[model samples]
Target: MEKIAAIIGGGVIGGGWAARFALMGWQVRVFDPDPEAERKIGEVMANAERALPMLYESPMPKRGEITFHDTIAEAVVGATYVQESVPERLEIKQKVYAELQKHVAENAVLASSTSGFKPSELQEGAARPQQILVAHPFNPVYLLPLAEVVPGQASLEVIEKASETLRDIGMYPLHIKAEIDAHVADRLLEAVWREALWLIKDGICTTEELDDAIRYGFGLRWAQMGLFETYRIAGGEAGMKHFMAQFGPALKWPWTKLMDVPEFNNDLVDLIAGQSDDQSGHMSIRELERLRDNNLVAMMRALKGQEAAAGKLIRDHDARLRGPLADEVPLVTVRRTVPVDWVDVNGHMNEGRYGQVFSDASEELMAHVGADRAYIDAGNSYFTAETNIKYLDETLVGEEFFVETRVALGEGKKLRLLHEMKRASDGAVLSSCDQFLLHVSLETRKSCPPLPDVLAAVEALADKHAG
Candidate 1:
């Protein structure tokens, strides 16, 4: 059965939701009164189609269909999930909900993208209020995993179902127990935003300078370890308590005008807007978004190597996406899309990435023959002795490719693999790798015969591929 998702507004956030759900194999129905809604959402989808798959080594689910409808009722007809991204005004949201309830299924999970409004506030004077909840997501929803889920009046079943749906589409749902204005992340952001405004107003720092201070400093730390963990590290050998004792008193110092409000006058707006324009006015919004996406992909991919933070989420999702290898003559060892970050200045997949693909294919083959992670951990494993790679064709970013491997030799203490990488769409051979490896005993760090089971499995594969 195909999952269906209804998006009530086709703005940036809504379009992102649509793209994410669709990319995750959910049929998306969209309704927005804007005449250019389709074009806007189309542009968002274009960016998403290119960027989202880069975060994973496995190929993404086949993209589901996206359709625009004239009315909310049409959009929600068969939807199991409805995401409302209309304007922030409470009255407007209430009206949309009222109309949506008329057509939406009783069991459907209705979520709002409002940043400030509590689920309790949105549920007032609504039909089946228990079905509604706040599922606030960050911008570029296709990439970011965080979705602050505020259950409010919603039932436990509904909340569970909503969380399951979010995780199914690769989102991390942080359940907020109590309904509060602006939720958790934004509340913290508000403090920083308030201080930033004051800084600009008081001539302490220009917008660019303030941004530079963050991007070149704490922003990098925050991306991985976040606030308290980073601060704990700052404490040195004593840990968090020592750091808190030293810096806690500074909170009382009049270093920030956080409680003070910068007047929302035209002069203030001009001052901030002029500085921002001077900083990044040269590039169009789409260009900026692409640049941001590229940077995020690079950073997150780095995190993936470390298996921390967002990278862990990505790795887990990749594991879920990966299926068992099928029984074939030349075992299909690797099937994945070339990520954006894999491409170098040459505008094609880098030579280094080809090495990675072959190495991964080799790992897959090793796993198949019972010499997997556990086998390696047990002090018995195959170590690559030598490899020769021939790059026969150009491979570009977003290209779907698979590697077929054959066991050229599998005997006492020696294993050789012949791998051919081919483009999925055309079956064109992109590259080939001939790898020679030796079974080694980790304790002695010398070539050794594999354990009985592993040796038998490898020999069997070699015999099968011998034809």
Candidate 2:
């Protein structure tokens, strides 16, 4: 049975939720009175379709259907999950919940995307308060992973299920034990916002300068290590405790006016808006979104190499999505879309990426022949001795491609293989590689013979491919 997710609002956040669910192979039902909801959601989906799949080495699941409904009942009828992304008004949300509770499944996770309201506040006057929880996510919800899940009185089973569902769609569901107004991230953001406003109003820095301070410096660090971890590195040999002790005195300094509220006057708005316009107002919102998405994809892909933070989540999800190697003579391996990061200034895949793809193909071949991770961990593994690659044609970003590997020779410590990469759409040969590898003992770091079982499996594969 196909999984179904109902989105109660089709604004930016709701459309993002729809895109994420649909892209992850969940049929989406959206309820929104806005006549432009379909067009808005369609734009979000287009951006999602281009960006999300580039984060993985494997193809994403076939996109599920997205249907817009006029009534809440129609949207939530068979949905196992319902995400509420309506207006922030408490009365409006409560009214929607009342109508939703009447039609949605008893077990459906009715989650709100409210950044300010606590789950307890959202649950007020609901027929089933236990069914509602706070699952607040960041902007560009399809790309970013964090989802703050605050369960006020929701059932434990419901929370677990919601977390699992979020994980399935590549989101990190941060469980907040105590329901607070504006859980975790937003609170930290509010502090920064307050300080930034003060800085702008006091004529210290323009909006562009404040943004530059973040993007050019600490923002990069925060992307991977986050606040405490990044600060711990500043402690030198002593770590977080020492760092905290050293900087703890600075907390009393009047450097920041976080407690002060800026007057919500038009002048302040004009100041910020005018400066922001001067900064990056030349590009359309869609253009800026695409630019942001591309930058995020590049950064995340770099992090994936180190298997750190959001990159680790992506790596784990990719492992789950990866299928077993197909049983064929020339083994099917390295099937993936050419990611945006793979393309160089020439507007084609960089030459180095070809080596990585062929290397992946060889790794798949290694795993297929019994010399898997376990075998490698047992002080034995293959090391590339030689490679000869012939670039036949240029491959562009977002082009789907696959490689076929054939074991030319597999005897004792020697393994020779051939790889051909072809575009999936037309089956045009893009590149070919001839590779030679040798089994090595990890302890000695020297060439050695493989284990009997591994040697036997490799020999069999080599023979099969020889024909």
Candidate 3:
């Protein structure tokens, strides 16, 4: 059965949550009072259109449709999961839960996206009290995979089921041992903010300087090793215990105000905003968010490719994995974009470009034929017989084109392929080629039939999409 999730609210956070679930292949039903929800969600989905597919090395699962509902009851009726991202007021949450209680099925898991409230408070008026829990996610939920699971006085079985569902949708859910206002992450963040404010009040480093200190220095390490792990490694022959022993004494230093809350005075607010304005300078919030996301995707993918232990574990465990092939057909998996080396003086993709394109297509086809580099070195090779190319559009340097190939004809010793090239940005068809290939025994350098299994696999794919 197709999985369905109902989201209550359509603000930025709700829309992001919707996109995250939808991209992971869950049909989303969203109920929001705002009449402009559809438009707002459309924008959010468009952003995901570019971002989600680029997050992995393999193609992602097909995205599910998003349906808008006028009433909470309509949204919750058949949904297997319900995510309530309503306003923060207690009354509003209670009322939403009351309405949700009457409609959601007994088996459906109910989650509130409240950042501050404990689950007990949100579930106070919930009819199906045990099913309601906190599934608080970080901002830009589509990009960040972390979600804190705060269960009320609910059955352990229900929380386990909810955790499993969250995993299926590609999230890492950390269950809180006991619920508290703001939970674990926010409490850490609050302490950092309080110290940051004190710094600004005391006229220390400017906001941009503070940001640079983190991003350029420790922020890079935080992505792969995290705070404690990085420190553990820094402890030399000793471990976390020794490191803590060495650094614990410094905790008492007046370097930071860990316990004190900054007064929200006029001068402090203005000072913070002024520093923020200086730090941001020209880039708008949307621009900064995009910059952050793009960098995160690139960095994370790079670390994953290196098989860094932490990255590898995260990729293996945190379920909703997606890659390049998810968004479009990967004709070739080149390491980098077409560079100046591949361009002609006319500033267009050079004649050598077609060869590069053909080579990539050939490799992918070989990957299908069991004649890849390793196979070739092991005495199997695929040689091109003839290639007929028709360039339909001019491609410039740095433009990315993915080719899709179909085995037009395949017999005992010869395979015919039809390839179409498309521009990644506009999905414009740029060129096409029809080619014939001969499998050869590399040591003898003569034509041969592909291995029985290879032939069968190729024939199966060719038969299915012989364009």
Candidate 4:
């Protein structure tokens, strides 16, 4: 059966949710009363298509169907998942859910994108209330991994099913144990907002300055270690408990005005917006979002290399994405869309990045030859002794590309590989890399003969890929 998702209200969150599922090969139907619904969703999907694939190292599945519908009933008729991103008002959501409950299939998991309203609040006065849960996702949901799975008086089965569905589409479903007004993430966000508002209202910092403090400092640490872990690292030799002991006394200090909220007056809003524009007035909002996405993709991928935080999630998902390659043609070692972050000031992929790209491709070939992570863990693996690269053409961001690789030689302890990087659009050879490698035993840190099984697999591949 084809996996289908029905999205209620084609707003930013709804459109993003649709993009996430649709990009993962799920047929998505969206319903909204607005005439501009399709256009809005198309815009969101365009942004999603450009950025989401860049986050993955493996070839993505084919993009799926995205159809806009006129009515909720029509949209939900056969959908396996129904996500409601209606306006934040409880009455509006309740009215929509009442109608939604009437049409959605019994097996479909019903979800809400409400950030403030608890699942219990949304569950009241609704038919099959147990089916509805607060499935809140952050803005730009296509890139971010978190999807807060807030359960109400719902069955554990539905929540578990929802969790599976979210993970299938590359989202981290954080199950909130006890439901409250805003749930976990937003409450933390609210605390930060209060402090930021105070800073702005007191003229202590401009909006740009406030943002700079985050992006340049704690944000980097928070991206990987988070608050607790970052604090734990700060403890030096003693660790988290010692750090808490040293910092606990400061908790009583009046360091922040968390209890107070500044009025979101028009002047304050204007002041903040004016400062923001002055800071990044050179780029359009779309251009800014692209920049932001590129930075995030780069940061996340860097973390992935270290197997930390959100990077680990991407790695885990990428591992599941791996499958056996076709037995025809050159082995497709690296197939991916060029991420925006790879582009340098010259408007092409950086020279250093090309090396990383080829290395990744070579790693894929190694894994295919039975010299994968396990082989490395077992203290034996291939190490590139030398690489000769020729860049035939410049590659830009979001360009589809693949590497054709073949084993040129596989002897007792020596291996040689050939790689050709081609642009998908024109089949142009953008680059080529010829790598010389040696199997090494990690325990002794010395050249060693390859394992018998790995050598056999390598020789088989070499024969098949022979000229």
Taking all chains together, each candidate's TM-score versus the true structure is 0.95, 0.96, 0.77, 0.93
What is candidate 4's lDDT per residue for 1-467, written digit by digit as tens? 78999999889899999999999889999999999999999998999999999888888888889998888999987898889999999999999989988888776799999999999989999778889898999979998999999999878888998999999999999999799999999999999999998898899998889999999999888988778889988999999899999999998999999977788899889988898888999899889888887888888888888998888999899878867666655888888899877888988999998899889988888888788888889888888899999999989989999999888998889899999999988899999999999999999989989989989988888888789
lDDT of 1 by residue, 377-445 (tens): 989888899999999999998788999999999999999999999999999999999999999999999
User: Model 1 misses residue 273 by how many Å?
Assistant: 1.5
Model 1 misplaced stretches (Cα beyond 4 Å): none
Tally clashes: model 4. Answer: 0
Name every residue pair that clashes in candidate 2.
none
Q: Between which residue pairs do clashes occur in model 3?
A: 56-323, 59-325, 59-326, 60-326, 170-320
Instruction: Tell me the deviation in Å of residue 280 in model 3.
Output: 1.5
Error of 3 at 248 (Å): 1.9
Model 3 / residue 399 / CA error / Å: 9.9
Error at 400, model 2, angstroms: 2.2
| Of candidates 4 and 2, the better by lDDT | 2
lDDT of 3 by residue, 1-467 (tens): 98999999989889998998898789999999899999998888876655655544334557899999889989986898888898889899989988888888988888988999998998786677898899899877887777899998767877998888887866778999799999998988888788888887888888888888888998788877778899998888988889999999998888887678778999888888887887786897668767766675667556756776334644664333522221222334332234334557888778666766766676666675565668777887778889988888887754555677777777777887777778877878887888888888887899998888778866765776654
RMSD of each: 1.7, 1.7, 6.0, 2.1
Off-target runs (Cα >4 Å) in candidate 2 are none
